[model samples]
Target: MTGQFQKSSMYMEHNPGIVENGDFRKNLDDDGRPKRTGTWMTASAHIITAVIGSGVLSLAWAIAQLGWVAGPAVLMAFSFITYFTSTLLADCYRSPDPVHGKRNYTYMDVVRANLGGRKVQLCGLAQYGNLIGVTIGYTITASISMVAVKRSNCFHKHGHHVKCRTSNNPFMIIFACIQILLSQIPNFHKLSWLSIIAAVMSFAYSSIGLGLSVAKVIAGPHARTTLTGGTVGIDVSASDKVWKTFQAIGDIAFAYAYSTVLVEIQDTLKSPPAENKAMKRATSIGIATTTVFYVLCGCVGYAAFGNDAPGNFLTGFGFYEPFWLVDLANICIAIHLIGAYQVFCQPIFGFVESQCAKRWPESKFINSEHAVNLPFHGAYCFNSFRLVWRTAYVVMTAILAMLFPFFNDFLGLLGAASFWPLTVYFPIEMYIARTKMPRFSFTWTWMKILSWACLVISLVSAAAAIQGLATDVKKYKPFQTEQ
Candidate 1:
């Protein structure tokens, strides 16, 4: 019994649990492990990355479909919902219990504990599917950016006579693989600095792009045009119902799909007591920054193109009045996207490393040789598996990009599916099941209502987005035609 207790103590020291009572200090050495400064920045950057993926670019089109008023309203609603749900999640982390401990409960664990095993499994599967879609979407976006760059450069030097096929080349595959490897280094502290820099760059690029887009739209000839007889240039006649369904699904999928990163944020922070405050502040800062950026981009994109907006913001550059702005926006967007990819890939690589170490005993190459030691051995193994897993990641990304080169619709659906479980549903469920609220308090009532609302919204939106994607696949069939 004494031996077991001692081992447990050692484990706790290595893998500190939830932040409660305001103790956020880490248990590991600062050499390679997470430090206070890095963890905060990484957490912030992760939120930004998750919030500002291909979705930012595509949302303009989605909003346009619903009309100017309805689209911006929905975006505002989404921002509020995200904020409220993230707050509830912070509350859940404040709960006192083994299950509520930091690094203990994944989005899956929280859902299962509150919603039931079945729901947990369902949500988990949905999240995984969403992640796959998101990964592919990022890859596709990267490819498109690369192609655009090559084509643009060629056009500048030799005029539009030369056709550039660089987007479809093998170099992108290699670049993505390299990115995955770099992200797998397992130094949260170091990555945090990168994330801050990335965040600054993303903010700057997004701001400039938004300003330029807005100016073009307002000053362009098409600013006052309205749809005649409810017809936008694109034909929605063949599959109106399917399109609507897909839209709703996309909303739900994207709304909470980003919640999984919360776990990563929690893990990187100093242990409970300290973790609690850091996480709340981090969540608040990150979510707020993301919301502002999304809203700004969405509004600008919608205003510029109105009903004619392309799914991705960058692609809509064709609508910009002065062609020079298009080139500038593309450069900013490309750099920002690269930063976004790095942030998004970090936690995923961490999770994979942990899982791999558990499955393979002799994979000491990850821990000792790679100089990556996680507080959790499982996490260490998963991180180590990066060398092997990265190849698969690259292959899958390339194949998916080839099959679905454009990710606007797919990203929407994925976001709706994953966002609810991770951000809204799981957090509320976890708090309700594990925490004791003050008797007859307004806070308790508000929380209950908020949780129920999130669940409902998540489900409805996910369904709609999925339906929308299915319709798009049927209508476009790019893969089939290519084959």
Candidate 2:
């Protein structure tokens, strides 16, 4: 015990910020940083903020493609898979021993610890690329919500037949501006309040959508719904139905694609109860909550609009009667996405900034932090490179969103690209490696089988999404997608 104390004292000499408590664990974390205050509740807020994003708004359209039985079944299945895999990932937040191993600060760090070399690079590419795609998708979705408010008002004032065409470019620009300001919030550690607000907004908009759908279902004639899916000849051709079904699967996958950032969220947790234990509980709660909302929104919306359900029920003008309520819901969606955009993109921002600082340590532009005083708020730490890079990143995504505003196609494609590799394959592989599960054993075989099945689903979803994008590209002109 004396020797251990001596070693800990020596370590503290170097890491001054960390001090050992009576339990021998540091008051501050293992890293020489401030003590983490995150509880299971904050972790749940982060997960909900990340998971219940713009993707949830598309679930109605996804269910429409799969019909009554298959739709709800698929939602429940994805929820279970996400929760299970997330628990496995939670165990991996620490190293060899889940409860007491060394900390991994980021998702890439976790991958590097378990599966090194080429796999690490692949994981980084998939994880960061998916984040970028998510930001772009959020930009498009937020703009759509903004446009929906204007269009809804226009429809209410004029007749339904009048063309209330509004260009999404302006709204996209406005969303980008808001993100530019929020992007300066530094890192994930400081985003708890924003995440909480976003979580509430997610629930609000989802509830509004659910209430509207239930009202529609009660009010009168609903669109035609089928048992299996879209009718072959009547609703769509056989080939189209196949593609739509696959795309719907992709949409569902995207809605559940928060695993990419799971480790980052876990890293925020204060440990005495252990980060893994807290994260597992948070994952269960977050996934269960979102799943309930998803089922209610998707199934009820499908019942209201059936096979013709809009890609985004709120923004798609499905509930046009209560114009004020529709406006409020869209406003909530836009606000929710504002925070969600920062949640996903901040990781990428941190990654780039860290790399730049490391590679160019002496470059004042990258390394220097300035204290800029605001009127009411306290002095803020500002970095020139951060401002320039993050603004450019937001601008680039905004431009891309304007160029390709095919909402459903983009969501499906992003989901298909990310679902297997980040959400399933990496977590499973890392878990297997960490556990050192014997090869070819029953457990090992089944895990591999699950991974392979998800891969197949991802591939088909990607193909379908590509087909849809191609079809939409032929119909709509870039930068001129008016609704």
Candidate 3:
């Protein structure tokens, strides 16, 4: 305990922005901000990469379930809602006094700063679950993407059993090892280069999916007409329509759900008080970029496959013309997830490393600097604590992925759990409280109502998702050569 205090004091000395009570000292510049540094382009790239997760692949199916009108409506609604909430988060980055606040670096920091109480613990639980789930989700997504491409070209091509020894298990395990290595990145800000690559990969694959779907729609009979292959038609009174639309709400929310990491990404910028101006601009551009792709991919995918669209169009697209395009797109997905797994996991390591430092103050394995000296032919640095935490973290996720390899199921569950709270509820509620808006005012009334509505929606979606998990569990078989 004494040594822990000493280390804590040391950390506080070196990082004056953080205090013993986990609050910022008032000695910071007017609007509690550090260096104002990151560029808008780089920030946009990071947001784009973070926002366009594997969820976008499900947008086509989401559209099919929501029907043409409701589908596009929900997408646009989520887009605008997320953008607004993101700006609120950007404004919240500053401390109590806008003129005399230090930036809140992490999501928990924001929660602790504004709405302090037992809510902190609740926030921690939800945030950690969401982040870890994201890492595991990435592994699950990558393995499926790779397996789809490989099976198309190798396993199925060779006339082997679909559940043979060489199935998705090996690829999943390999990517888990890869994540262990990528998770070495010291902090969230350092992921700029990888985010750029990830953004391009997202664009590349999404564009291909859109283009092919458009081609199929054009080539098919009654291409210009509204034909729904029976399941989804103009009447829209299908048996499970309402439930499926709620499910689609979860998917759209998932695709638009990047708010959890928005503040962390903002901290990477180099401005005093981490200027909201830059963050707002980045948020706008990021949403704009993703919206373009989302609309194209979702529309084409729904039009081409109609109600038959699977939860993930990549797997559902089947072996169509220009087969190599599918392989290339899948390859891009694998690479993008590699970078994304690191982006989300970096913050988890931040949480873990902080706890470890608090726990084992004297151990050399855990350092105060959040940094390490890797003498790689010169001065390439690494964090020893990071090395340990990330390795174990990846291994745990890998094991889980191996045990239950349900890609969309896990995605839906995590999205339902975190999307509403992180993306919609917290941001607006925090904004209302911090700004001291009148509880009875028209603006405050509407915003508060919206926030509560979203919270309720999230709760319902979570219940539905959990109820479906029983089916997934029944189907999963660990270590079985075939799925």
Candidate 4:
């Protein structure tokens, strides 16, 4: 880190107007870009928007698999691990010196600065792959919520006993079309409003779920629950129990998967008190807020439905009466996912566009941005490549979602694939490298142990999720997923 600092300082000496905290500088950022105005509050909103996503909807089923004692315990455990490693990764946003060092714009940049070589390629593959999976998951989740709204009304009119099955394919198409428009928002700098709206929607649906679960618990006829979760012989077979427990771990792991885009989020922050400082504080607040909500939703939902808990409280038809409230909750979920798909996909869009611009520097199609004035709105810079590429990406994910709309399985697989590599291993390795901790030191050893343990967890979770996906695929045909 010190050596890198020397190189950065040398480069800064050669570059005149791009120095941080310069008195004689124009109203531009240290990178010679527009000034960043993101405060800790906006950063916190972004974190919350990313953290509390579709994964939260599956927590009741996850808790049902793990039972009462282990469920809440595992949730809290992931909360601690996520916050701790986030603080570590936050510091790496600036190399050599976290406060004054040159910025690493993306997660890949952080890895290249701290631990270069093949690790950078591996980090990109993991980060981008996980992002693709998340967007697909969000598409499926949003479609489910949309279908749930209609189903809730149907159940209310025709009674819960009627077989009111609805296909998710149409709804998935609807969500993809919505994403195609929102995906053209340019970049993260322009996404604060969407994220803020998404964050509020997340809170709205989460609070509604929690409130409904509490009501169900108080309504008198509570389902059976146990400290050890599902009974082996009655609720599930022995082998089934093991798979579900692992899948539950994966679900919880996915719920805390905001680290992949942490640096990107941090890049939006203004630095006077330092970007790393604000990001760390935002991470702490975001994780703490999500943890409280997770506990309430998971534990209370488990208490309400017990071993028979649905995969999603709102969309899985957990509540029937007060159908209007259920419809509102589902509507909230759909709105939140609309924003979330953009929050996660913007990085992919930016990365691909930047790379294209570098490769074909003279191409007008990819490089040109045409300014068009709207009736009431200001000038909008339109790019042809962005429209085509992002539209294709959205359409692809929606088709995939329509093919296999297994909600819990997809969430678990994405969580398992991303949690260890992007969330645990890379962050720990980069932190250790930046700090230059001795291999045999106590703290270093502990960090390595933690990373490896998470690896094992991720592996088992992946296996279970794969098995679950295979089972679901065998039962249903593609593009014909009915709720």
Best-matching candidate per lDDT: 4
Q: Write the per-residue lDDT of candidate 1 for residues 1-483, one digit (tens) a residue.
A: 011111111122334452222344443433223343435556777667666654566665666666555566666676667766676665554335443443443555556545576887786676656666766666766666655655565566776545544544354575576566565554444466566665666676577667766777767765432322114345456466345534633552364346665655565665444555666677778777776776777667767776666666554344333445556656655556666665555555555555555555344454323223445533232332456666677677667777665465666656665665676666665666665667457877886677676666656666666665676677874423210
- TM-scores for every predicted model: 0.75, 0.92, 0.86, 0.93
Looking at model 2, the pairs that clash are none
Structure candidate 4, residue pairs in collision = 67-229
- The sequence of per-residue lDDT tens digits that candidate 3 reaches over residues 362-477 is 66556643322344533334445667778988999888877767745765777787777778777887887797898789998888788887787787777667656766678767
lDDT of 3: 0.74
Sequence-dependent TM-score of model 2? 0.92
RMSD of every prediction: 7.2, 5.5, 5.2, 5.9
Sequence-dependent TM-score of model 3:
0.86
- After the best TM-score superposition of candidate 3, give how far the Cα of residue 156 lies from its true spot, in angstroms: 8.4
lDDT of 4: 0.86
Candidate 2 per-residue lDDT over residues 288-405, each given as its tens digit: 9999999998888888898888888888777787899999999999999999998899889878876776677557677666676776977677777888999999999998887777
Clashes of each: 43, 0, 17, 1
Better of 1 and 4 by TM-score: 4
lDDT against the true structure, each candidate: 0.57, 0.84, 0.74, 0.86
User: Per-residue lDDT tens digits of candidate 4, residues 1-483?
Assistant: 011111121123334344556553455667666568898999999999999995687799999999889999999999999999999899999987899898888899999999999989988988898888888888988888998898888889998888787888888889988888888887898899999999999999999999999999999697999999999999999999999999888888778889888999999998797999999999999999999999999999999999999988888888987999999999999999999888888889878877777677556677666676666867677777888999999999998887667755776676787789888998899888887899979999999999999999999999999999899878866545457
Best by TM-score: 4
Off by over 4 Å in 3: 1-37, 155-166, 222-239, 272-274, 358-362, 368-378, 477-483
Order by lDDT, highest first: 4, 2, 3, 1
